[model samples]
Target: MAKIKVVLIEDSVVALEILQRLINSSEEVEVVGTALDGASGLQVIEQNQPDVICTDLQMPGMDGLEFTKEVMKRFPRPVLVVSNAVQPSDVDNIYNLMQAGALDFFPKPTSGISTDYERLKSALVTKIKVLASKRVS
Candidate 1:
């Protein structure tokens, strides 16, 4: 089976590495490109044309909501939001992200202590595969 190509957009270097490792652990997923900010994220997405995009909701420039809107407007691909923010407002942001055309959202493990990597990995892989199967229209 062809692996699901994924582009990761995150501002934190550490979180980005963690996410990459988790996603690559799945046999069905591949990390084709990565970026620390939304502008570069758009560039990489355009260049790679990956099957899905996983992005952080909070970033230095052009947050995930804005990125999702632009990607939906220009590229129109499946977007899965992965963010560290878990507060009420952050949770509410997921709705906005969806409104801007995100396919789903995954909250990062709080406190930076991930004891359930396997479960998270499984869920992310499953979401990626499912989203990749859906047509934008």
Candidate 2:
């Protein structure tokens, strides 16, 4: 079986590291590459051609929604927007990202793999695996 390649984009170093580890532990998914901002993430996707994208909504240069719109125009891969910040004011941003072709969103874990680590890992693995099917040619 082929592994699902996932390109993760996040600004927080801690969140980025944790998410990398979490996703890498899954047998179905592999962390192909990572980026600190949306622009870099988009470039990485264009270069690497990953199977899925898990990005933070708030990032420098482009941000997640802007990146999603640009990505949809060209790549059109499955994008899962996972963020640590979840405020009511972000509803429109989230909605726009989805409308722009994002696949789904999940509230990032508040703690560093402490608050229900296994559950989060399982959900991520399951969700990304399903999304991978849609990305493959």
Checking candidate 2 for backbone clashes, the offending pairs are none
Residue-level lDDT of model 1, residues 28-111, one tens digit each, is 999999999999999999999999999998898799889999999989989998886634577578678878899887876544
Cα-based lDDT for every prediction: 0.87, 0.84
The deviation in Å at residue 123 for candidate 1 is: 1.1
Best by lDDT: 1
Backbone clashes in candidate 2 total: 0
Candidate 2: tens digits of C-alpha lDDT, residues 1-137: 99999999999888888888889988889999899998888788988899999999888789888888888888888988888553456787777876888888777765556777889899988888888878522
**Poorest lDDT segment (10 consecutive residues) of candidate 1:** 105-114
Q: Using Cα atoms with residue i matched to residue i, what is each candidate's TM-score against the true structure?
A: 0.91, 0.90
